[model samples]
Target: MNALETNGLSKEYTGNWGKRTKVSALNGLTIQVEHGQIYGFLGPNGAGKSTTIKLLLGLIAPTAGTGSLFGISIHDKRARERVGFLPEDPSFCAYLRADEFLDLCGKVLHMDREQRKKRIAETLQMVGLPDKATTRISQFSRGMLQRIGLAQALMNKPDLVVLDEPLNGLDPYGRKELKALLQVQKSQGKTVFFSSHILSDVQEMCDQVGILNRGQLVECGKLKEMLPVRNVRLKVSTMDMDTVNRLEPLVASMTREHHHWIIQLEGASRTDEVCAILRGHAQQSIEITRTTETLEEFFFRRIEENNLERGITRPEPIMAMAEA
Candidate 1:
């Protein structure tokens, strides 16, 4: 079953003065996440990533369309019960200690006292804050607070976890630790849906990715399929200036390094043709490797294409709020 699904989910905000000015925070965003998968929501700043999360959390109502969590309507309070959420900026009772905060969350979830105690201990350790269980939240560092927020989200042991900009306040070590925790959740058959600006982490951790631009989903699919081999690189030994000039049209680019020439073919299909052309040149050996566009590259390319399509010289930020 799909963990999350949206159909033309859109949100709009109107100016305080009048209805004449309107902003579309999210525009007809339709996407899905399957069970037990790590889905990454990627976009630049103010791209409606957080807006979508808020809508899913039922913090705001959508102006158009609908969404669901594990088949339950997002509008239904019960739907949120099965979902754990960590907002981009989370605020808690600063006076409460870490363990107290988690215990309070457990009580809110109606977990039994014994169960809450056991889960709290496990969660604190899982988030690398076992030693800080007695420390007040106000005394915690930004990274530590983020970890505590994550722990509370998992305290309920919900089937689906939604995190907004989860790596924002984390150090390198903390980031790596969180990534491993996410992987562990996946292993245990829990679905993970997160938004992040860190493309490298998304590229490494997500099985599926959706790229949002100007409140629209420009790309969504398996990470592997979304990033395809854009070109092929061939290393040849018998390549000289004459060979380079002759093969210039067939290849995207070429350069000589030390004893061999590095040629970039436009596509994989041209590999055989280029190899045949190089056969008569008496090359000792040839090494051909396909190069795929990275997630960062694909993201910018999509944004650029979208801008060009809309005749927009400079893209404006998408609205990130919904009208009451």
Candidate 2:
């Protein structure tokens, strides 16, 4: 069974007044996350990413459709016990000590006193807060607070970890540690699903990804298939000007620096044709490399195309499409 599944999941908020009265935050969203895979959820601002997380965690009821965790309904209490969540901005009791807050969280998860003790120590060490065991949360720095929040989320040893903007407050070293921790989680056969604005980090770790635009999923697929090698760069040294002229029409761009010549071909197919022309050339050496589209490039391109299709010149407020 899939670790997480959603079918036509939609949410439309209804309120008393203002443009926020009736807002369609999400629409007909369907997705499945498998076990032991790191799934990255990406989207532009106001793209229904927050609303989807709220639905999956049962923080709010969906206007239509359903979701399940490990084959159990999202509304079921048991299903939530198997999942851990870290919100974009989490705040806890400032008066409580680091261990105290985690102990309370573990209690809420129904962990025994002895279990909470051992787990709290382990989680504290895991998040690099072991030295602050007795320190009050009010004394922690922004990054330190983030670490504590992460510690609480993991106290239960959950099967699936869901995070919203997890990389927001972390420094470079903190981000690196967090990524390593996520990799460790995957090694232990745990599923991790997180939403982030950091595309490079997403590209480095995610096995699969789903991108939302204007309340709908515009793209969803494995990373390999989404960003395939598209262009080829051929570098050759000691090429004659006559050969350069013969190669001009077949390449996208060609330039020379000292004795080194660089040429860009549209695709791999064109490389073969170019190679045929220089088959017997007495060149020093030839090197060819393929380049793939970056996640940032693919993201903006998809969002731009999707926006154009929906007649959105720019990002509009939630009220732009609200109904009351």
Candidate 3:
């Protein structure tokens, strides 16, 4: 069964009561997250990431269309029972200890005292916060608070985990630990759907990614398939300056490191041409590597393409506008 599915899900808000200005927070967002996969929801600020999350959680009703969790309507209370969520900015009672907060979460899920105790212990350890159980939440560091917030989300042992900006405020160590935890969740057949601005994290961890722009899904697919091959990087050593000068025009770009030159060719088709040139220069120590566009590069390219297609251009400067 699909972990989550949305069809034409949309949300709109009225800006002013009298003016009746409508702002579309989400528009016809259709995507599916399969069970046991880590799906990354990506977008710039105010691109409807939060709005879609709220709609799926039934915290806010959509202005159009619908969604479901584990084949159950998102509007159904039972759907929430199978899901766990961590918001972008989570708040907890300052005076409550880590364990106390998790216990309260368990109670809300109707877990018994014994079950809550067991799950709380396991969750704290899972999030690498076992030692912070008795520490007051007010004293926790930002990373610690994020970990504890994740701990509560996992406390319910839900099948679907929805996290918004899950890596926010995490140090390198904390981020690494959380990535490992997410991998563990995937191994146990849990589906994770998370929204994050951290492109590198999404690139490394997500099985599939959906990109949202101006409240619309511009691209959605598996990471490997969505990223197009862009260039081939050839690292060559012991090539003479004469050869470098001769071959510079045929390649897209070249940069000199301490002892070797890194050459970027437009495509793999140029590999043989580059090799022939290297051989002609009597260079034997050459390494040819194919490099694809990174997630960040692909993201920007997609957004730019979308803008061009829609004729969305930057406004003219004040002076230019006045002259026009």
- Summing lDDT over every window of 10 consecutive residues in candidate 1, give the lowest-scoring window: 315-324
* Candidate 2 stretches greater than 4 Å from native: 17-20, 234-263, 268-288, 315-324
lDDT of each: 0.92, 0.89, 0.90
Model 1 agreement with the true structure over 1-324: per-residue lDDT tens digits: 599999999999776785588888899999999999999999877789999999999999999999999999999998898889999988899999999999999999999999999999999999999999899999999999899999999998989999999998999999999999999999999999999999999999999999998898999999988887888999887676676777889988888789888998775778888888788677789998887899999999998898788775763445633331
Candidate 3 lDDT over 1-324, as tens digits, reads 689999999999878768878999999999999999999999888889989998999999999998999999998978888888999889889899999999999999999999999999999999888898999999998888889999988988889999999899999988999899999999999999999999998999999999998888999989988888788888987778888887888999888899888988896777888789889989978887777889999999998898788776755769998898
Per-candidate clashes come to 0, 0, 0
Off by over 4 Å in 3: 16-19, 232-265, 268-289, 313-324
Local error of candidate 2 at 260, Å? 11
Identify the runs in model 1 with alpha carbons over 4 angstroms from their true place: 17-20, 233-264, 271-289, 315-324
Best by lDDT: 1
Clashes of 2: 0
Positional deviation of 224 in candidate 3, in angstroms? 0.3
- lDDT digits (tens) for residues 22-47 of candidate 2: 87889999999999999999998888
TM-score of 2: 0.83
Candidate 3: lDDT of 188? 97
Clashing pairs in 2: none
